[model samples]
Target: MLEDQANDPAIVDQVLEKSGLSRDDLTSATYSAQKEALFVRFACDVLADATFAARAGLQFKSSSSLTAYISKYSRDLKQVLENASRFHGLIDPALMFSLRVAGNFAAIEAEWKDASYARYHRRTEFLLFAGLARLRDLTQSNFFPIEIRFQHEVGSSRNKYQRLAGFPVLFGAERVEIVLALSSLDLPVPTYDPKLREHLLEYGDRVIAEKRQPKQKLRAQVEGLITRSLPGAIIQSEDAAANLGLSARTFARRLKEEGTSYREIVEDLRCDLAQTFITNGMPLSEIAFSLGYADQPAFSTAFKRWTGQAPSAFRSRLDVSAKA
Candidate 1:
């Protein structure tokens, strides 16, 4: 959006290069100080409009891969929010979304996990308007939020935001969030598909598992290899290190420097997948096989050691909690 709105689109690339980021880094899960600096410089230095962030935000359609997945798979606003909360790290690692219900209002609270990035009010406003734009597109509703809250003071841009939002835009609030009537969450998305939603959700989770790993980190690379090789022969440590073109001793030393080992990584990865499979109601034997365990007994023993409960007992408790 900034590129299109710029007087010279080339300037956007120039700014990105100046900030020490590449075009490819824009969609990656890793957060970069250089990327954040680019936004600050663009809005404050180049555009020189206090409301440029909000303006650019509202004009943004759901063109990113993550937003396209949400548009196609989500059943309604509630599902949209759920997917956003779960997989948002794939696109924006610095912020998180959570749904909050208070009396008659349902709020989509935007919390900044990176305080340095959050301090830029323009970036926050851009995210706010961009989110509103996407929700409006998905829900096929022109309705504005009941009110908007900002943690920052309402400078001279209050009126500009009010004009854009067509509703109350409050400033200096407890947190940054978009508030709506509780019933709004039930609005159906035109593209909802139950089966496709399930498939895409699993895909999203896998993408997240891969993307959330630091790009060049040894541990992350090992985890990715393990994940891809699952349900077949589990790749042994020496083979994994060989795949990465590292000698076994060098691999062990590097992993130890990173405060982990290949065995520990395998254990941790299986524990995570075990819980996810249990939650999804996969059969115990299937979960065991998927995690590359030789048999149900071995998987069950490992699971009990990890969670201090039998697989059957864990599934039963999950069912009970769901019923509750």
Candidate 2:
């Protein structure tokens, strides 16, 4: 991470405030280092732009890591949308940077699945409303027009939509998107500084290029292996590497070059699977079997270790908390 505290002070402040954490929370030497990963995950969860998170110095092992972070931090779909709204001002800039980065990254496909594409559209809607709200407060502009581009067929929480954004909402158009006039994008942020903006943009470009380099082949391979290993599929690191057309030693070497390891990737995938299953109310035994655990007891032990609670207890707590 860059040691220069002056590069993007506004962004740094925003990240700290949104995360409810301070710089010392990240840098305190006596703190358990493992907690840092959780903080990084929190940062990723609230930031609409992945590139912006990277520029803020949160290192991720894969795109799945980002998804997992969002899933864990967001208790429900509404919470996810709310956080997306809070970070709306940063989304446009972040998306612009992401587009540049995605163009350079060979592994990222140009097309998005319907579910994935809808997520971005919804996020953009939240952003537009939040941006307009900010502008309204700043300039007392009551005439700002807000338009959303998702169709009624695209299912979302209608109650929340009506409650949070009271604007002219349109659905089912030529595009699954939201549009804001350039005037909205150009609204002056009270904290904005030209030099800091330039620095962040440059830093974002650099980080994107670094992530796109061929040296991160192991990172890509691990992501592919995790994606391929569906429920009931047993995957070994050596086998995964072989499937990637590389020897185990070569894969390890490449991962080292990318500043991560096979074990880290495996652990990340397991955590992701566990969370998804828990959230979806899949049976513990079934989840264990799906992840290739030998038996229920073994799976329970692993779950306890991972989250400090039994699967049943976790589910019970989630249910109780949801009611509260």
Candidate 3:
């Protein structure tokens, strides 16, 4: 990897010199997350554009890796994406990325775990399309998303961005994410092989069953399922477990080991989302409806449980504060 990247002028050469990493280490050694982060920062300094990451995403294929083979033959787009999210750490352990569905849309959200890679956030978000592109290739389907979004501002030319993605890009969103219609996520990948995909999934199950679950990753997987399910479907442990192909009892036990519960995670996400909508001045009823509440009264009851204040009162205080 280092040999291939060594001659790339878009990345600072000295970073490799100072990194104590040689081409040999790329073959024989593992680097820490911080080392990986340093390389990205160095790239930010030397690279003229952020789309490099996005462009790199198009290079994905059913490579020699078992994961890629799993991805290549996946039965559906959901399996391809779920497996991608599961093994994405192979790209960079310092990055946290998820493909989540909610309401009428889905989003592929990403962020650097280290604050130091903050400058690379936009590039990371743009890579969503690249992932989409690879998915299109793997499935041999032309699946264009409804919209693309990023938290950071875009300095790249609009025409160029459109050309690369063949889609519109929107910036300055709440999170570094790319948006897609929920329908897009369900489309079958054209090249899907049921037998290979099923065999891989089953083999995956046996492999994981033989090992101890990694708490942080298991939490992120559950969180992704919950995030996708919220504002539309009611989140239940059974449902999340099903999504993960795990038994409900196993899911609950794992979550307990991770020092959290399904209810707690749901409440945390709801409170955060409620606050965001409230700050944006959305009506209580509308917020309630969007948050999957049947009626304002039930939502208000839940809001008070989440925030110790009725949603109306909370909005009223915000209104007063804004005026003052």
Candidate 4:
């Protein structure tokens, strides 16, 4: 939700050192950037109890949106890391640093959604295995001890514990935790702002608490409407309100109380859809039409205003590269 540049080199260094890898292993790939950035953030936060960088890192330079970064790098990072265990023999500290960084990034997608406890657990497991594998490769020690705490009972997959995480897996615990060696925590990574970290934690707590309540139903309804109606269908406030069985005025008041507006929701939806359409190589005219635009010219004008490039030109560049 927070869109900022990523500039956390300490996090990068910490992951690499922890995994015993370095930067030379990543010279040929650009797709791993996002995963690398996020891995650094997550690893740093876990180890240092703060964000990877005190501020946004260098990866945030070209894109102001975190979602954009994720969209671009998620797959590439995964691909690069598919064969990570093969690099276990490298002894250079710097190379170890890079491998750790890559490993952290590779494990990120698994742990991305804290909202879903199951998803969070699954990701944590994957991250533990990946981290341990890297450690094993570096130290030549296959028997690493890892302690995992889960929010609910571990699911009934007999091999779930053994097949995924090679270490000890504990479930139905009071809190979620992954215990590795104390030395793993020794990687020198700076903490982000304490106040900001506290704020974020508090925010996460509130979100988790809210998810446990019945009021989340309303939020779900709102999200459903936003997802259902967007660029092509400019859903009017009154119309959307009517669909929800509320009077237009009442719906507007409720949205205001919730700290959002119908227009803002529409704009956000448009922005999300526009990015998807652009990435998928949809013609601007078609995209505009699909989004309920009047004509190609109108869509072209709006696309330029949104992204600083005409839709056709953007598509053309993509096409040229594809041919090349």
The candidate maximizing TM-score is 1
Q: Write one digit per residue (lDDT tens) for candidate 2, span 1-324.
A: 322432566655565655466777656533332233334433433332222222342122122223223322343322323333333223122222011112212110112121212223323343334433433443333434445443312223333344435554454344433344433433333433446444544554454555532232456557656544645666788887888799999888988988998878766666655754564456677778777788989888888888898888987875665455
In Å, residue 172's CA in model 1 sits off its true spot by 1.5
* CA error at residue 117 for candidate 2, angstroms: 13
Q: Model 2 segments beyond 4 Å from truth?
A: 1-217, 257-260
Candidate 2 versus truth, CA RMSD in Å, comes to 13.7
How many clashes would you count in candidate 4?
Answer: 26
Cα shift from native, residue 3, model 3 (Å): 9.5
lDDT of 1 by residue, 1-324 (tens): 667666686878776777676667776735464367456445443454456677777877766565467655688998888788887766665578888888988999987654334435667777888888888888888877899888655334467778877899887588889998989889889989889888878888778777644445787678768765755467999999999999999999999999999999989878866765564346788778878988999999999999999999987875665455
Provide the lDDT at 25 for model 2: 66
Candidate 4 wrongly placed segments (more than 4 Å): 1-214, 217-220, 230-232, 316-324
Give lDDT: candidate 4, residue 299: 72
lDDT of 3 by residue, 149-183 (tens): 76444432345556777788775566766677777
Return model 1's CA RMSD, one decimal.
Answer: 19.3
**C-alpha lDDT of candidate 2 relative to the true structure:** 0.46
In order, the Cα lDDT scores of the candidates are: 0.75, 0.46, 0.63, 0.44
Model 2: how far residue 68 lies from native, Å: 27
What C-alpha lDDT does candidate 1 achieve relative to the native structure?
0.75
Q: Which portions of model 1 show Cα errors greater than 4 Å?
A: 1-6, 10-14, 21-37, 208-324
Worst 10 residues of 1 by lDDT: 40-49
